[model samples]
Target: MAEDRSEQEPARRPGGRTARVRHRILEAAAELIARDGIGGLRYDQVAELAEVNKTSVYRNWPDRTALVADALATFSADVAPLRDSGDIDADLVDFLEAIAAALSSRQGRALLNVVGAAHDNPDLRAVVDDAIAQRLATLSQRIKAAIETGELPAVDSHLLVEMLSGPVHLLVSRGTRELTRADAQRITSIVLAGVRATAAQHTIALAGEHDGGKTPAARP
Candidate 1:
């Protein structure tokens, strides 16, 4: 009953089979966590859900925490912006929508379950903290890079990430209405408006300093 994907992989190569197997295990873990929370996640259950042997699960993951960490890491990677699309407006809209979709997906629910459990378990909390830190660091770098290229205004990257993601997280994490692509677009528009306004203010302030604190006269 093991779901050996060797034959199902697009490539008949060894690497293809390995990739397929890894995806299956990660997906199985994500689904189990979504359905039953972290307490219900066990190697046996993971093996059953993945349709693989328990030994196979152990051979690949080696530990429970390791499996959970890898699964969450994969989810985070999916949500991160790997490249800029040259159009800031379109790019930001797509970026936020991708985040909304990821966090609301079954895999995202599974990730949140692990996070919720970490609240009381110090050891588990440490592991989850490390995993999240890794996720955030990667994302923060991209935000910083945008600022450097003048695509974004100078602002706290972490704070910007929080502001960008908080609303969607609140609604979805609280079991409220799911965030839609339209909603994501609107949210990005608002945030960008604020950022542009702030950048303009900064420009005005610098101009005032250059002009000995006098307002420049408007051209007729």
Candidate 2:
């Protein structure tokens, strides 16, 4: 009725402005969280850092948990994503390198600290657990595929991930030294070799049982 003001206004593409605003708010939230942990994130600070209206933050995220969850989710996706390149060794080395890089960053360390203290914060615990589970699921899938292709022995994917990632986390958290590509390679090699050898022994043991416990030398 107001002289068709809608038509007079510039056509706004869907999710253009809204998406940019959401991205900015999320980035600001992550930065603040990285600098000061979860307790330090404030809407005023987020609004100021994001350069968006304070109402934008309020309208987008219902509460601190929601905002933190989204920020962590986005951070996880960007930080460390496991990829399978049909070569398990190289793939694992790359994955480990990514982990090292992430842990060395301010954002990554902040997120890890949040996770470390998650036991004290139920809301943060739930969010961190969910994000971690999602990432592990991806790693599990890649490990499963490698097993199927005979690139890896049949092993517990979760344990395998723990084995591979544990060293990186330890080295980075301790500030012992910088993680190098050689370290990633050595970790990958040692773990994979152990897994393969274990699988081989298991297979030989099963074969012995099937052959009435007769050793190869004892056979005709």
TM-scores for all predictions:
0.72, 0.81
lDDT of 2 by residue, 154-212 (tens): 89999999898889888987787999999999999999999988888888778888989
Candidate 2, position 116, lDDT: 67
Q: Which candidate should be chosen as best, given lDDT against the real structure?
A: 2
Cα distance off (Å), candidate 2, residue 57: 2.0
Which ranges of candidate 2 are over 4 A from the true structure? 1-13, 79-85, 105-107, 216-220
Model 2 alpha-carbon miss at residue 213, Å: 3.1
User: Per-residue lDDT for 117-217 in model 1, tens only?
Assistant: 98887766876666545545655776788888988889898887777777777777887787888888888789878877887787887888898979673
- Largest TM-score belongs to which candidate? 2
lDDT of 1: 0.75
In candidate 2 the C-alpha lDDT for residue 33 amounts to: 81
